[model samples]
Target: MTIEEQIEKSRTSIFKAVFPNTTNHYDTLFGGTAMQLMDEVAFITATRFSRQKMVTVSSDKIDFTKPIPSGTIVELVGGVKHVGNTSLKVHVDVFIEEMYSSQRESAISGEFTFVAIDEDRNPTTIVSYQ
Candidate 1:
């Protein structure tokens, strides 16, 4: 497959149910929890894109635009945004969905950079099918 096709096929998404245990005092999904989930999704996206062992090196600014209340559903979507020799960036977005309706809105977004590594944990080049 072409590089574009590989990246397109690497797109990953996961759905989660917001529960009271994950909410904060404001009864909304905790920022830290959302971030953890985003990072996980980003990691998956990077791995899927390259089929390599990858580790997150950094995370870009994360913005929370809306609150995700408890008892709701959330969908996290992740995709490869940029590719480099040994590193790549994945963009992740969290969308809040009403359990009883079709209403959905973007609640958070962020970018994470990951570096491909070899068995020795050293940086390795990412092979692309161009």
Candidate 2:
């Protein structure tokens, strides 16, 4: 399917983690925290397609385009990009909204691969819901 088709089946969410007053000296969100959220976003997208547990097998590429200030809002959007018999690939993008503004800009984006597994943790085919 085309990238646009994948995007149409995408899911997006906004998440925030409190950084106590002393957590940031520069008053910006920590890079590590941002990455954690990014991973979750990717996982969620893949899991939605699998309807089961998903583990990140690989990250194709992750590019950080900007920094997100501490008090700003973070948005993570993810969707399926491709699917094989037992594997699904998801693309996730992270964005940040300014404290006093609604504008959001891309902060980072990555692609993750997940393999479907059964209760025994063995690889299994991921059926298409479409």
Please, what is the TM-score per model? 0.97, 0.81
Clashes of each: 0, 0
TM-score of 1: 0.97
The superposed Cα distance between candidate 1 and the true structure at residue 130, in angstroms, equals: 5.6
92-126 per-residue lDDT for model 2 (tens digits): 88877776877878888888888888899988887
lDDT of 1 by residue, 1-130 (tens): 9888999999999999999999999999999999999999999999999989999999999999999999999999999999999999999999999999999999999999999999999999998866
**Top-scoring candidate (TM-score):** 1
Name the regions of candidate 2 deviating beyond 4 angstroms.
1-10, 17-25
Regions of model 1 farther than 4 Å from truth: none
